[model samples]
Each structure stands twice: as structure tokens, then as C-alpha cells.
Target: MGIVRLIDRQGNRHELQALEGWRVMEILRDWGMFVPPRCGGSGQCGMCHVKVAEDWSGKVLPPGELEAKVLPLLPGRGETSRLSCQILWSETLDGLTVALP
Candidate 1:
């Protein structure tokens, strides 16, 4: 298991235990966080947008072609924007931090 620190829209911080091999969106949703992954984990919807902490951005894999295309269309996206549904969690991501937009 790894730790994912999530910052909600309200600016509240939540430390969640992440299971390896799970999508970040799944971990957030399972913890009762508000990531409306309308397209499930397919990267078709930009609803699960999150801004990864700058320092941690390089730690995760880059978005795939489909995700890259969709990310730019999302509102409030930034340089480190990513779809939680497209991010696969792993032990190497322990302590990864992201903020909900």
C-alpha cells in the first residue's frame, strides 16, 4: 500500500491509503472523495481532473495519447494536470499529492 494525499476543493486535506494497481480515481472514489469519473477509468471524461504537486509530477507516468487529448479540454487544468482515472497507483507513488480543481 502507498499513501496519496488529496486536497479537496474545500482546501481540506485527506491522507488516503492507496492500493497498488488501482487507478487513483478508484482510490479517491472509494474513500468517499468527490471524483465523478463519468467515463469510469477509460480516460474519456475529464471529470476526474487533478493537479499533481509540481515536485511529484515527474514521479508518475505521463498521460497516454487519449488522456493527453482530453486533459487540455478540461477547465482549471494546469501544467501538471492529470485525470485521476488515468493514473495507476503503485508503491512508488507513496506520498504523492494532488489537489482537486
Candidate 2:
């Protein structure tokens, strides 16, 4: 398991216990963190957008093809922008922090 931190657009912070192999979006939505997951973790809807914390940006895996295609269209897309549904929880992601966009 891992501890994932989510910061909302309003600057509110929420911490959740994330299980291995679970998607970040799943954890956030299950914990009522405000992620819509409109596409049910299918990577189609961009409502699960989150920005990796600058300090931990390199810890998470890079975006795959679908994410690459969808992310750019969202406002404030940047090096840290990522779809929460596409992020898999693992030991490497322990203590990961992200901000809702």
C-alpha cells in the first residue's frame, strides 16, 4: 500500500491509503476527493486530470499513448499534468502527491 496526497484546486489537501495495482483515480474517487471519473477509468474523459507535485513528478510512470493524446487538450497542460486514471499505484509511488487541475 501507499499514501497518496491529493490537493484540490481550492488548495485543500486530502490523504488516502492507496493499494498496489489500483489506479490513482479510483482511490481519489472512492475517497470522495472530487475526481469525476466520468469515463469510468477508461481514459476517455479528461475530468480526472491531476498535476504531479514538482518534487515527485519523475517518480510516476510516463503517460501512455491514450494519455498523450488526451492530455494536451486540457487547459494548463504541462510537464506535470497527468490523467489520474492512468496512474497505477505501486511502491515507487508511495507518498505521491498531486493537485487537481
Candidate 3:
């Protein structure tokens, strides 16, 4: 298992241990965090967009398909943007910190 930290726009932090290979968005919806699953966890919706401050987790970024479509529609879209449904958690991501926009 790996630890993932999610911070809201207000600077609130939420930390959880995620299973390896599960995408970041999967954890959010599975744990029923505040994430609004407008498309039922589908990669099409940009509602689950979050900011990855540092992703040393070695989590392979999902293919350009989902991100290419979702990132631009969201509020915070810098270098680190993985459609919550697209990111898979890895052991290296134990201390990963992300800010939800």
C-alpha cells in the first residue's frame, strides 16, 4: 500500500493509504471523498482534476487520451495533471501530495 495526500483549494489536507496500481481517482471515489463523480468515475469529466505538487510516487501518468481532453477544461492545469481516474498509485507515491482545485 502507498500513502497519498490530497489538499483542497483551501489548503486542507487529506491523507490515505492507497493500494498499488489503483488510480488516484479510484481512491477518491472508492473512499467516497468529497470528489464529485459527475461521470461516475469516467475519464471524460474533468470534475476530479487535482494538482500534483510532487509525484515521486513513480506513478506512470495515464495515456494522453484522458488528460489531453480533461486538463484544459479544469481550473488548475500546470505540469502535473492526471484525470483522477487516470493516475495509478504506486509504492513510490507514498508521500505524494496533491492540491485539489
lDDT of 3 by residue, 11-41 (tens): 8788887999887888876766766668866
Better of 2 and 3 by TM-score: 2
Poorest lDDT segment (10 consecutive residues) of candidate 2: 29-38
Model 2, span 1-64: residue lDDT tens: 7799989889988889999999999999889887477799889888899999999888888899
Clashing pairs in 2: none
lDDT of 1 by residue, 29-88 (tens): 999998467787799988889999999999999999999999889999899999999889
Backbone clashes, candidate 1: 0
Question: Of the pair 1 and 2, which is ahead by lDDT?
Answer: 1
Instruction: Report residue 14 deviation for candidate 1 (angstroms).
Output: 0.5
Runs in model 1 deviating more than 4 A are none
- Sort by lDDT, best first: what order? 1, 2, 3
Taking all chains together, each candidate's TM-score versus the true structure is 0.96, 0.93, 0.78
Better of 1 and 2 by TM-score: 1
Instruction: Give the candidates in order of TM-score, highest first.
Output: 1, 2, 3
lDDT of 1 at 45: 80
After superposing candidate 3 on the true structure, give the runs of residues whose Cα lies further than 4 Å from its correct spot.
55-59
* lDDT by candidate, in order shown: 0.92, 0.90, 0.73
